[model samples]
Target chain A: MIILIDKKGFVLSLDAAVAVVLVTIILMGSAFFFLKTNETFIVNMQMLRVGSDITAVLQADGTLDTLDPLQIKSGIEEILPISYNMRMLINSTASSSIIIVETESAQTNKKFIVAGKRFFYAVQGGNAYPSAVTYEVWPK
Target chain B: MKKAVFFTLSLTMFAFIVLSLSFIFAGNAATDDARFMELASINRIYDLDTSLQNSFSKIFSLDSEMTYTASTTEAIFQQKIPFNFTRLNNSFNNLRNFAIYNDKNVQVGLLPNNVSLRVSQAGIVNWQNISKNITEFMRTNSTPKSYSFIIDFFEINITSCSSSSASGNFSFSVAATGGNGTSCNQTLSINPLQDASVEISLGTKSLTVLFSNYSASVNARDNKVALTSRINYADTGVKPKIFLESKINITVPGLIAKKYGDLRIA
Candidate 1:
């Protein structure tokens, strides 16, 4: 029979609880957005790394130096994962470039794409020739 | 009422703090990610540069090896240098996107016109065309040690004056002079002579020499030579994937010898 409660205190407590809930909802929304963007960024970085490694190995093996398409194809096949698609643009001159090699995996409609480029030296006709190789990669 | 206000203020402050901390962490994560990517790109560039340097050194080494072996006669040179030479050539064919821009006809001496050898990936060894190119280049440059082998004589007989069609891979004219100062121009063929004695008279002196018992010295000056070389992988049917259309100026030193001599062709 001694149930004496302060209406003011009850009202304050309820209001505080509502504020906390709203703030929590906002925090969660922002965190979700940020984390999702971070994941996407990380994926792109990984793609870039893979592309760079492929070009480096080809250059080191003298396959890039000779412009051997068959060897280059085999090298790429060994390095790239089965789930990814890759295309290469090879050009001798900076201006009026040409598409030397282009390849894609069985899966199409890739959701993400990244590209990396590097220059390599090629010897042909008893001369040293310089060329630029660009690789475009994406997950299937 | 005052307590309620205070509670609301504290809750708002806590939420802001949480939000601010998360933003800061996100920023740091983004910055770290960008930095990592930049570092990776730089590393790749360095690797590519190093690879190019190593390849260049290999090419230079091959060029030196060929230069040192130039003293061997043409036949030996042809027989031995193809393996190393093909490797040298294969290096050129490996680049897929390579371009060479040699606008000026700068005489890159590595493939000087005087060095007659053009080997394609199809395993075509055209020595005669190469010889013609080299002879013209040497004549233009007036380079010393520019010797050519136009003909090789294995055996020949001249019991009587007779002319026959040239059947050997190479043909050349020979000049003979007896001790008596009588000089005669003789033609030698690669076919073995059949039981014949040759006589030459010079200035009131005649020397008889048996064709079968004599050794011949062969010298070529600005001559064309042709030989067929089978590439090991030609049967594999792998065509050259890349053909470099650009003209680059690459100076390969000591690619061709100044002179080749002392060829005793039996």
Candidate 2:
């Protein structure tokens, strides 16, 4: 038996190769779409938006300057919605760890977190202190 | 061969359509991310603005306005407060401690080079050229937005005999021993931002004309406040709504935002 090679089959081979590549890409794209759709995208985005708004309101009223855990906790509680829970971690030059303020549910059991970090300066004793405040929000 | 070629072309076209659809959806996602980031960036910028402003006031207030305890003394600025581009930038940078912020590959960070202060009051052309003695100290302040000035609004050098009473945002009675005593009640409008004067002569007897907060306060007491005491004139430098605006640009991987917001550092 002699092996036969046909030059005319070249285009057919090229098409098969191209088709294989296309099919793989389509599969990968479909997988990505399905995976993405399964996740809580809107909730996470809402969390981010909520976090941003919360920080803005806190910074606006000069409440961030106090650096008091209790005060910050109250401020967050006032701004955040009833359904969401938030925890803030503040780091300033004046103290190694100034305060970490959070709601009860924010620290509890399960976790789906969206975090935003903001840089601000707080006035402490006639001097301004630069601070990095991070807010993490999760749905209750 | 023809059928194979047609099939390949058809598959390529289908792939292109899928990719285009993906891009359209991806574009919307990018927009959402930008919106959220922008909102956050603006809030943070606002905080930074107030912080810088409050810091400026604190520094100056420590020097003059707030108390006289440590006048001309602060870690921020030495000798005189810097108003130039370079010095002010240096001063503000010295005030903050952003460990590794605005560094390479930072997804969200302020571009340090892009942060700049506009010290010259907007309306006053070439304010940078003005000296500290005249611009900063002598006159309280006059800006495009608002002004409260402590300027010598009137210079009355009475050379001859004259009895005169003045009105309009201010009032003065010069009991002249000898002025151009034509019994002239001059109704003059005062615009201190510009060089303004009413020369009334008190006959070689030197009279000290003092302008206190009264000029500004009276002008403020009435909106478009005119003395209108048989005289109608309004010259109020807008009560000096002082604010220091800085242009700062923040950047993410794909977005660049230039903020010309008022830092309110005054």
Candidate 3:
């Protein structure tokens, strides 16, 4: 009825144009899928950022120097969001490194775990000592 | 047939373009992950440096170290700086897989002995006791201007009295005497040091002399940024997450002074 076909039964008009356009669409769709953001990695980075910020807050407020695990624990809980959980470990040259502070049942296995740490001087037994604070965070 | 060939060729070109774009996107994603891990390691390295500096400064304020002459002061400061470095190194060795820390990752001064105090942040304890003593001594004396208090190596002399106001503002001047005087001549920066921070109070039943940087002569806030920080990093058997064992001699910039001349109100 009005097919645009060449003498050799080849499509040379609208059909060819439509085929080219369809191929372009498929390629574009695949490109988008390929470029879909790696959100898991981004979330991990964000979790690490939150962990670092909490430690920074602790150090800034001077609660870290007290070496009182209770004060440090409360300090972390006050700043951490409700949707996430945290666990803090303190390591000092004066003492063995251990989990000094934590949120409610912060299990690292609940989700993908992101960890962060901080370092500073804290006085214990009348001596200023070097100490490291490590924190692990996960979504609840 | 020519048209078929042309359409096929066009499709192939589109496929190539899309594949190239995907690779570029993937490459960006990888570098970003590496960059974040790098950033975390660098932060740890910086904390290691500050711990060493603070330890050095705190030693000067120790009751044990205060009795030394200038030579002994230098000796003690030099000898004591190594105390924290090894402990910190071993503690940090636990995190090497993160590739942000390793053995001897952060160094202050020189390595293998010769660790000098890059920035001294010694603080005098029993401050409340000393300040109260000074105020009480000055209040009862007929000529208050002649009053001076010496704590082992440091002397606080009160003179050139304009007037004695309430206990809200104060100032200090320090000059090193009878030694090499390596760093005592530099204008003091008192710690608990949030810039332009802290109120030094001296009080009695009726009189108080306070020192705040708000006054003209107290220790002005100064911040030091160390750019020569070299961090050694190595990680192997991981692709794109980190590089092969390579030395990352990065010149860390904007490292703020951790602690110096701490004035604790004990």
Candidate 4:
């Protein structure tokens, strides 16, 4: 009788052990899920800040005068604590259409005309992703 | 009894495993969030750069004629033939540390309300501090020229600001090249070959500009001067980044017609 009782007690304990193991597995799974969600949220926030700065700098007309390559570099350096690298490029593009303006002369049969007003400035930059910024300007 | 002891031990191990896993997952989540935020900020900067470029293009298209007219008495005109030294001085004041080099390579430090007695056809202008003489020269001798204008922008790193050192130590440069007149044929070329260049460096980031050159050629009998231009940029920086470049081109149809006549009547 005593042996039987001991045997029954051991089986019950075994069942309890199995139940505890199951609970631990569930806890670990939950923790992983929480970690992943939080990470996604933080990344999104960083991206937002970067976008804001870019917009602010570009929208500033007075800032354009200050768009010296060196100054821009400095600005990036100022913001480097945030872990971002910045670059800018302004190039003239051959993609242009000629415009011809003609005027009939009042004094003679000759007409006055102007031509060759085709040219563009290409502005491009690279970040985590490659992007191009183009500024087109005609002759003065 | 042995069976009971074994079962108890197994349950304890299981509980420990569960707790450890949970902690690991939680820690990972936080790290992931940080990484994501960093990437987002970088993207935002790029987007702004793209938008700025688009805006500049629109403006350039609307004002393809890069001409700005000012009377002899106009502030810009009264400054001089080769440059409006006064305006240049003012512009430098707005920048943290400004410097200019003329064809002669003479460095002229521009100071607020300051004037210099040195007289020359072309020389450098440096704006390290404000001075009285520099101001006078800008008002009296500065002149606007008919051809190209070289504008430089510098960025100074503000390491620290106190009574001892008010300004930052580091700087980077960006230049805008604009041209006018009959002799400015190469300056206005639209091809990539005709563009000029400026060197820029910020910390570890660096790049070079190959300005687009645009050119237009008419009959020798025609009075209109030929024009050409080229513009180009390349990334020599550590990471890919975006930036904005804005330029305005104005063409005075009436003025060109009066000066060159049929030469521009293409």
Clashes per candidate (backbone, < 3 Å): 19, 18, 8, 105
lDDT of 3 at B55: 37
Give lDDT: candidate 2, residue A1.
14
Whole-structure CA lDDT of model 2: 0.46
Per-residue accuracy of model 2 over A1-140 as CA lDDT, tens digit each: 12224444465556666766776676567556644643455666678779877876787587887888888889988878999989888877767765788896436677777776666667777766667677888988
Chain A TM-score of each candidate structure, as shown: 0.77, 0.69, 0.67, 0.44
Candidate 1 to native Cα RMSD, angstroms: 17.8
Interface quality of candidate 4 as DockQ: 0.20
Q: Which candidate number would show the highest TM-score if scored against the true structure? A: 2
Per-residue accuracy of model 2 over B136-244 as CA lDDT, tens digit each:
2112243222222221112333354222223334443222222233322333333333332223333442222222232211111101111111111233423223333
What TM-score, computed on C-alpha atoms, does each candidate reach? 0.42, 0.46, 0.45, 0.28
Instruction: Chain B TM-score per candidate, please.
Output: 0.25, 0.34, 0.27, 0.27
Candidate 1's C-alpha runs over 4 A off are: A1-6, A65-70, A92-99, A105-112, A123-128, B1-13, B29-37, B40-44, B58-266
Give the winner by lDDT: 2
- Ten residues in sequence with the least summed lDDT for candidate 1 chain B: B257-266
After TM-score superposition, what is the CA distance of residue B73 in candidate 1 from its true location, in Å? 39
- Write the number of the candidate with greater DockQ, choosing between 2 and 4: 4
Evaluate model 4: give its lDDT: 0.31
Alpha-carbon lDDT, every model: 0.44, 0.46, 0.41, 0.31
By TM-score, the candidates rank as 2, 3, 1, 4
| DockQ of model 2, rounded to 2 decimals | 0.16
Off by over 4 Å in 4: A1-22, A25-140, B1-11, B60-224, B229-266
Off by over 4 Å in 2: A1-41, A104-112, A124-128, B1-94, B97-131, B136-245, B253-262
The weakest ten consecutive residues by lDDT in model 3 chain B span: B223-232
